[model samples]
Target: MGVDDQSTLQPMDDTAWTFLDGRIDAVLTTVRAESADRAAQGQALTALITSLG
Candidate 1:
């Protein structure tokens, strides 16, 4: 998913999309780790993970 400034710039290229995927995966992994370690926060994490989907 790419957004352009001023709603006019071109979409990101394939390499940029790959980089975005890597960053997104890193964030998801971090969230999952936190969720595993904090049962009380599972609901919030679930919401975040679901929203990502």
Candidate 2:
């Protein structure tokens, strides 16, 4: 579905919002963990390069 299709959609009820919010939270948590892991890896790589120089 596209953004235009969403315009015709009805408003969600509390139950739907609750379910969507939970899913969003789970995705956000995963993204945050992955971001942190990448940052740590970058720092380690930088340290390794510095040590070699």
Candidate 3:
């Protein structure tokens, strides 16, 4: 799914992860969210590093 598609998804609750289909859209969605969060963290760290230089 595209990034625009992801914007329409409601944030999953903890229990929602347990009932994922065998096709695992929930797993993929969670992974994508995590990857986006990590990317944001990396950008924040990079900014800090640049500021320290």
Candidate 4:
């Protein structure tokens, strides 16, 4: 779905979050230097991860 398609998104349960977080870490480890857009995305994901705690 598109970024603007909020209607299709739903919040996951705590169990799902725990599962996804590990997978996300695995994917994130492969990430390297890129453009400012990726930097912005990293910042935003960091904020979301922080909010879950």
Alpha-carbon TM-score of each model against the true structure: 0.41, 0.41, 0.32, 0.34
| lDDT tens digits, residue span 1-53, model 3 | 75434333324433432333322543345446734676555555554455435
Model 3 lDDT on a 0 to 1 scale: 0.44
lDDT of 4 by residue, 2-51 (tens): 64343333343556555656656644654543533566557656755765
lDDT of 2: 0.51
lDDT per residue (tens digit) for residues 1-53 in model 2:
76434333324355554555455554455556745666555555554455435
Whose lDDT is higher: candidate 2's or candidate 3's? 2
Please provide the root mean square deviation of candidate 1 (C-alpha atoms, Å): 9.1
Go through the candidates in order and give each one's C-alpha lDDT: 0.53, 0.51, 0.44, 0.54
Tell me the spans in candidate 3 whose CA falls farther than 4 Å from its real position: 1-36
Q: Candidate 4 versus the native: TM-score? A: 0.34
> Could you give me the TM-score of model 1 versus the true structure?
0.41
lDDT of 2 at 52: 38
Please, what are the lDDT tens digits per residue for candidate 1 over residues 4-46? 5523332445655555555556556666673464543555555
CA RMSD per model (angstroms):
9.1, 14.8, 15.1, 10.3
Best model per lDDT = 4
